[model samples]
Structure formats: structure tokens, C-alpha cells
Target: MPDLALDIAFAWATLLLFGGGLLLLRARDAMHRILALDVLVSIVVAQLTILSYSRDVSYYIDAALALALLSFTATLVVARYVTRGRPF
Candidate 1:
């Protein structure tokens, strides 16, 4: 059923978020940790978007946009820190 598939998707997304968190903890290098952190954030955003669709809530969409902006800034800052140079 379509509902079952949606539920499965949600479960899978949660697993992905958990796995990313573990990766972030286990990752040794700064770059790898940053990538894992980004993946975790992306998974959370995906979950929020899916919930928004299911509930027909416009507020979650706004939350997704805010997450995107903050994640982008975080990535940039982490990249600069990891590379020790400006990203151009």
C-alpha cells in the first residue's frame, strides 16, 4: 500500500540520520566529519519535508529552508577551517 511505502521511507530516513550521526562520531578527519554532519542534517531536512507533505503543513517547509541556509553556512565555515584557506 502507498501508506506502507511512506512509512518505510520515513523509517529509512531515520536510520540514515542515525547512521550519519555514528559516522560523525567515528570519523577521524575534520573533512570527513563535516561531510557526515552535513549528511545528517540533510537527512533531518528530508524527514521534515516528508512530514510536511503528509501533514500539509506550510511551517515545516519554512523550517526546511532555514535548515538549508544554516547547513550551507556551516559547510562553508567547516571547509575553510579544514582547508585553512578561503574558499573561492
Candidate 2:
């Protein structure tokens, strides 16, 4: 029962993340897109955390942490590029 519950939860989360990502892709403003990207990344992290509960491994958490940091940096860089008109 618990296993089935987890599977359902994962499926729901995946659908939500994909939907949010598509919305982000359709956003007109770069900033809005970036924010949406952040939301998607967070959803991915949440999914990974849930996976950790069943996998008996903490590696996913570490990767999720790394992804959080990388996503933050990516958002900052894209914002800067959009604002400054250059990578710099």
C-alpha cells in the first residue's frame, strides 16, 4: 500500500513539474522564465528526496543539493545576461 502510494505521488509530481516547465517555456519575459525554471528545479529536488525514501541511498540528496546550487548560479547568470545584454 505504501509502495503504491509513493508511486502515485511520484507520478503526480512528475506531471506537475512537466506542466510547470511548459508554462515557463511559454513565458514572455526572461525573468518569469527564470523563476519558472527555479520552480521546476525545486520540483525535481522534491522528487529526488522522495526517491531517497525508497532507495536506501543518500546520494540523490547530495546530487539534489548540487543541482540547487547550480540552478541558483544559472538563474543569476541568465538574469545578468538579460539585464546587461552580455555574459560578462
Clashes of each: 0, 0
Off by over 4 Å in 1: 85-88
Q: Which digits, one per residue and each the tens of the lDDT, describe model 2 over residues 24-67?
A: 97999888998899899999988998798878799999988999
Q: Each candidate: what lDDT?
A: 0.88, 0.90
Candidate 1 TM-score to native: 0.89
**1-88, model 1: which lDDT tens digit per residue?**
8678778889999999888988999999989988998898899889988888878898998999899899999899879977986555
Q: Specify the poorest-scoring 10-residue window by lDDT in model 2.
A: 48-57
Question: In model 1, how large is the Cα lDDT of residue 87?
Answer: 59
